[model samples]
Target: MAALRKAIQELKQLKEQCVEEQGVEMAALRETNQELQQQKQRCVEEKDKELAALLKENKTLKQEKQRCVEEKDAKTAALQKTNQELKQQKDRCAEEKAVKIAALRERNQELTQLKEHCVKEEAKMAALQTKNQELKQQKSRCVEEKDAEMAALLKENQTLKQEKERCVVEEVKVDKKEDVEVKVEPEVRHDVKMNALEIEQKLLRGNIEELNMKYGKLLKIHEKDKAEMAALRKTNQHLKQLKEPCVEEKDAEMAALQKTNQELKQEKLRFLEVKHFEIVVLHERNHELQQQKERCVEEKDAEIVASHERNQELEQQKERCVEEKDAEIVALHERNQELEQQKERCVEEKDAEIVALHERNQELEQQKERCVEEKDAEIVASHERNQELEQQKERCVEEKDAEIVALHERNQELEQQKERCVEEKDAEIVALHERNQELEQQKERCVEEKDAEIVALHERNLELEQQKERCVEEKDAEIVALHERNQELEQQKERCVEEKDAEIVALHERNQELEQQKERCVEEKDAEIAALLKKQLKKPPKALCVVKEELVEVKVELEVEQEVRVDQPEQTNEPIPTTQRRTTPRWRRVINSFYCIRPNVNDD
Candidate 1:
């Protein structure tokens, strides 16, 4: 009865301790919640200011649109006055465009003639590029090999670090032992660890020495390459120096030739004049070739500088990659801290678990101390066994954790490699598909006997497309919930602003509709103008048709704008999300006006 009372008293004390801890944690959480609320309020205030700015921008955009409309009306009025003038200009433009096209066609013919000359130059450039590529490849191979070695060293360093840390922790545990004999086992283990670490450090020093030797060799090779490059630069400089005097001498000879040709022109009139002109063209081409040679020299110098920078960058990148791999191991300490924090949080959350854990820990500590004292005389043999088992369990757990982390890293690397492979293959596969499509199109055009095969292939493609669509649908369905959840959360965050801006959003919608209608009306009017201009140049314009077209354009714009204004406001009272806004047609019209009209300018 007395023992039961004592146990009950301990339980009460444990409960009290748990309550106190919970109270402290609750106070901390409340403070954190209050801080978060204040921050959120500040964010809301800032967002309100941003909303006001956006509203101002909206008004400015509206003003710009109105200005654009006014400008369009004025432009239309001026265009009516200048319609006759534009017809004359359009004829002049067409003639100019035709002459330009002919000139371009002649230029293409000239370029084709020049392609034969450039072929030899291109071959020479290819040879130079190949040489550069080979040198780059060699440097890349060296960098890759160095990176591999560095990675190996990094792994070794990490293992050594882990072992060193384990030893330190073991030393800390050993320090807590009361008995000298009990401490003796840990002390011996510590000595063995210290010896192992010293031996490993020695090995590391030897590896470092070997790496230094290799690095020295590499440096020597780099110096030799640098000397070769310097020699090449000197040779290029010498060539340039030689070419300058030769070019001057050629110019002198060409001037002398021109004097002779001019004298010959008196005897052989038109024929000599044409020959002289041909000679001048050849000289110009010679000058251009000389300029190209200079450009090539400058480009080669740039490439050499780039290669040097690239080599340095590669070395730095390799070092960073190795260091990053080593840095990953540092996260193990962070993970341990996170686990401790998680445990504290779990204890804070679950009073029963914390209380039970406290009870068990206290009971175990008491029993262990009491048992050690009581058992020492009775069964001193058990001490070493218990200590060994505990050490072995700890080591096993640590090894397993290390193995898991290593495996996870390996798995990630494999996944990344697989994704890269897939990406590379996808490009090739797409090219192959395009080639097949081209073949099919060619077959269809040629009325081939393999029509049956093509039909079968087409059917198969359709089936595959259907299957792809099904797969896409399934994937979309899976992804939609996740997207919807995210959107909902975002909407909830912005709901405060959204409610206040509902009227503004509705106004925006109406304005957007009006803008769309205005753009369409403008586009139709421009297209009508282009057509009218085309007609006026081709045939005399009918006054009745022109008047009807202008009236129709004005009425259409007015009706569309009025309809949009009436309908948009009623339906758009609820705030529409930015993401859900439809893409307006004005962008398409602008693109069409710029990109499409020019191509068809001479098509008619």
Candidate 2:
């Protein structure tokens, strides 16, 4: 720029010098013109032949002077134009120089700022480096601490595991000891008692195993939760790296961070894999426990049967003992009867013994009546106890039914969450499809702008590409998620249906049980009614026998009175028995144990 400015100044000086030289040349030409005019005047004065030649020469000289002036003017105008262009070029150059200077100054400022920034950055980097080093040291220390803690925790876990195992073993041993003790008591009994003992042992074993499996599952879940937390931290770090750029450094740092992120993602995947394995293990344990529970239930059922048999045996033994006692009482009664017969023969001459025996019989009948009343009270109490037991069983069934309803509700919530997930997936797929359509439209417009003749073709190609991408993305996504959702809903529906089926089965079972209970109650009522009818029949026959006895006693009294009247006929002629007949008793009293009725005997 300075060079150009100096060049322009030199050119301007040269132009000024040329103008001065042209002015001097023009002054000399003017002087020559005046001398020529004077020469012309002289030529006229001379009036000779040299005068025409002088005039021709003078005119030619005048033409040459005009040509010189025109040439000078053309050169001056050319110079002026050149000067203008140069001035413009100089101005442009000056502007360019100013721009360059500004740029240079800016660059210098930038360089200085950059240098300062570099220093600051260097300090920052040093600080960061120190921090990084500190972080590295801290990380190392953290790693060391974590490793130590992990080792310690692992050792503690191992010790806890060992203790758990020992506890499990001790529990098993104690369970076995309890089982043995339970067995020993039953072994002494040897029949149903042993069965009961074995059932209890099996139940205990099943419960123990179930508890152990649950504990193991809980432990595994705890471990999985810890692992999941670690994995989440790793994933969080990875995601942070992916989302944020390393603005402090270049692309290399970006690449490194990406690599680290990939590593972290891989680690997360590994953790997921471990979790899956743990889940599988837990499932297996659950399956084993379920099987154990099933076996225990079966054993319990067998024990119930055994207990029922033992109860029957005990009842039979009680009945046998009662029968034996009854037989002894009967034999004692026969011995008392023989003594009574001997006493009767001895008392044939003394009537007082007979009266005493009659009174004793009346006391014995009263005692029998008291015993029958006590038996009836016992029977009524047994019936009440049975009713209470039935009510309790019904309440238990109702509770189980409520639990089933809750389970069904939970299942419905799970189904709804699954549906929501499916819908979200579908929405995501639809958004992707819309994006694909938009991309295709953009592509079609781009193609249309490029080539009109091939616009349709380009559009078609774009459409096809978009369609293909959508097809692949949407079809795969839609098929997988839709199919999965469909399958899930199907499975859920099936599960719901299965649960309904189970509920139906339970309902059916309950209905069947209720039907059976109703049948039993009906049978019991029928039996009770039959017993009441039998007692009614027996009471009527006894009442008829008592009526017949009363009638016979009245008939005997009439006959004895008639014979006495016959023997005293002459002494009491005035009261001589008239043949007037007395009317028969009109009403008979019926005693029916729980009810008494009077029957009119007018027809009789």
Candidate 3:
């Protein structure tokens, strides 16, 4: 019994030690689970922060894309407006060129007709001069013939006077001889001499009247020829005065035409230069747009790759958390099995002890019956020995009674010990039941916590999925928008290319027109220069003096026109600065300088 008690005490101590050990293991498992939960919570927080940062970055990128799109749209709009304005300017230039060409053609025709008319007038003037010369020679010849006839008449008159003197002297001598003969012959001879003298005096008087009439007629014819020559000289002067003004007006018209041609040529060249500049600007803009597109695409690809990597990391974390949870659940299941096995062994040991105690109680009852029978036999013998052995028998009975009392006391102690042991077993069973209830509660709590954690993990997974879906949707939307923008850009590029081609064609046409204009201007300038030289050569001194003043005025006008052309470039909204203009090609600069200098020289 002592050994059994010792064994039972040892078993109780072992059970207490196992219970303490299980409690410590449960504490350690709880601590580890709490730490795992804390770590998972921290991981979730970090993932959330990363997701938030990624979202913020994505939003910023989208906003930048929108801003870029708006800026591109504004630039495209501005380019379109500029293109329209340029097209309008080109149209206006074309109209102006056409109008100028028509005016030039009309002016050329007028100049040609004027030249023909001038030629005819000059021929007519030459013919009239020749006719005037013929008239003057015929008048001189008439005067010479009249002078010779007058000389002949004067000589004859002198001879007639001498003959008249001789006749008078002969008449006096005849009168003296007749007077002497009359005295002798009587009255008939004196009457015949008187009749002959009277007839001679009447014939001399008629000849004197004819000579006076002839001298008066010759003086009247000389006065009439002098008056006719003076009238012809006046008419020739009037015709020359009338032709001078017409020739001067023709020359002025030619000069104006030449100036207009030069202006047109300059304008064409300016337009061509402006077109080339616009083309260069457009090409630069296109290149910049392409570079911007490439940069945007690269940035988007980088962002997508980063997001994908982040998602992969999150998935790995979730897998690690699940693995940890599975390991914890497996450990908990193993701990429950160990606790159940210990409880079963304790119950089996208690049953074996109860069977051994029952067998010992049956053997003690048989020994007590045999001891009662021997005591009865000993009482019989003491009676047989009678009174002489009474004292010794009495003493022996007392000893037996003492032994029975000791055995009862011992039985009472054994019963007390068994009662104590049963009480201890009941207490231990109650403690085990309490421990099992605690463990069950703990397991239920652990299961509930696990369920809650699972719920939280499921909710987190759903949230992550939703976030991924939203990110994908946003990315898809962005891609669609970028595709649309790319298409618009492509269309814009094609349109710009077409516009450039059109502009190039137009420029080529304008260049051809400018070349033709230049040729025409050169021709017109040559014609004007020839006309000026001819006028200088052919004009009378008084006409040349008038022309020099008019030429100076024309040159001044040409200079003013050239200055206006130079000022025209300044009228542009963004004119090239003087420094930039000075950097122009040498040939262009030389051409401009020549034009400017020529007019000044002509003015001088």
Q: For residues 53-128, could you state the per-residue lDDT of candidate 2 as single tens digits?
A: 4577568656755654464345335434643553464355446445544543443344344334333333433443
- Tens digits of per-residue lDDT, candidate 1, 1-604, equal 9999999999999999999999999999899768756865665675576567657756765675465445434533443344334335434544644454454344334333333323322333344445556766876787787688778768877986897698678767656552455736766766886797689778878977887898788778878777866765574465456446544654564465456446533534553364357436534643453354344233334433453465467558657855864674465457556755764565455544433443354364455446435534423333353345446534644654464455446446544654664576577568657866765675454445345546877999999999999999999998998899989989897996787687677687677886796688678767865664554453324643544464466556556755765575667665555653565544334334433423214555
**Full-model lDDT, candidate 1:** 0.57
**Best by the TM-score measure:** 3
Candidate 1 to truth, TM: 0.20
lDDT of 3 at 423: 75
Each candidate: what lDDT?
Answer: 0.57, 0.54, 0.59
Distance (Å) between predicted and true CA of 565, model 2?
A: 99
Candidate 2's clash total is: 0
* TM-score pick, better of 1 and 2: 1
- For residues 54-108, what per-residue lDDT tens digits would candidate 3 score against the true structure? 5775686577657655654554455445445544554454555445445444444
Better structure of 1 and 3 per TM-score = 3
Candidate no. 3 TM-score: 0.32
